[model samples]
Target: MGRIAAGDGESYARSISTSSNVEIRRRTRVTDIAQRVAKLMWQWAAHIVRRKDGRWGPKVLEWQPRTGKRSVGRPPKRWTDDIKRVAGIR
Candidate 1:
C-alpha cells in the first residue's frame, strides 16, 4: 500500500483496554473479575481432582492409574495438564 502509517498513531487501531474500565469492585473490569473467578475455579478443580476417591466433578478431570507401563519419557497428557499449562499453574 502507498500509506505505510495508515493505522499508525491512530487510537482507532488500538484495542480497548480493560484496566481503564471500572467494575463492581470499583478498581477492575468485568473481564478481570471473570478471569479471577475462572482461575479460582481452576485451582479448586485441581484440589478436587487431588482427592483420593470420589465421583465428584474433578474426579473425572483427573487422570487415572495406567494398567500398563508408560514409555521411557514424559507421561501422557491430560485435560487438566493442558489446563494447568494455559492457566500457569504448578
Candidate 2:
C-alpha cells in the first residue's frame, strides 16, 4: 500500500478502481455497460424513494417550476422519465 501510494498515484488509483469494478461485476454477474448503468439507476431511484429524511434530491425530482415556459418544440427528457420508460410504470 505504501509502495503504491509512493509510486504513480494515477495508475494506482486506476488499478484500485478497476479491481473494484471487476469485483462488482463478478458478484452481480453483469458485464455490459448499458445493463450496469440501468441497474444502478434503478437502485439509486429506489434508494431515494425509500429515504425517510427530507432531502433536496427527492424534493427536486417532485418539484415543478411554476413560472417556466417552453421555448422549444419538445421538452427535455428528465432522469425520472428515462427510468419510467426503461422499467415501465409501477
Q: How well does each candidate superpose onto the true structure, as a TM-score?
A: 0.34, 0.57
The alpha-carbon root-mean-square deviation between model 1 and the true structure, to one decimal in Å, is 9.9
Model 2 scores a C-alpha lDDT of 0.78
Question: Which candidate number maximizes lDDT?
Answer: 2
Clash pairs, model 2 backbone: none
lDDT of 1 by residue, 2-65 (tens): 4546666354335334434554346432456677876887787768767767566665675585
* lDDT at 17, model 2: 76
**Model 1: lowest-lDDT 10 consecutive positions:** 11-20
Ten contiguous residues minimizing lDDT sum, candidate 2: 1-10
Candidate 2 lDDT, 17-56, residue by residue in tens:
7787668687678887988798899898889888869878
What's the CA RMSD of model 2 in angstroms? 9.2
Question: What Cα-based lDDT does every candidate model obtain?
Answer: 0.64, 0.78
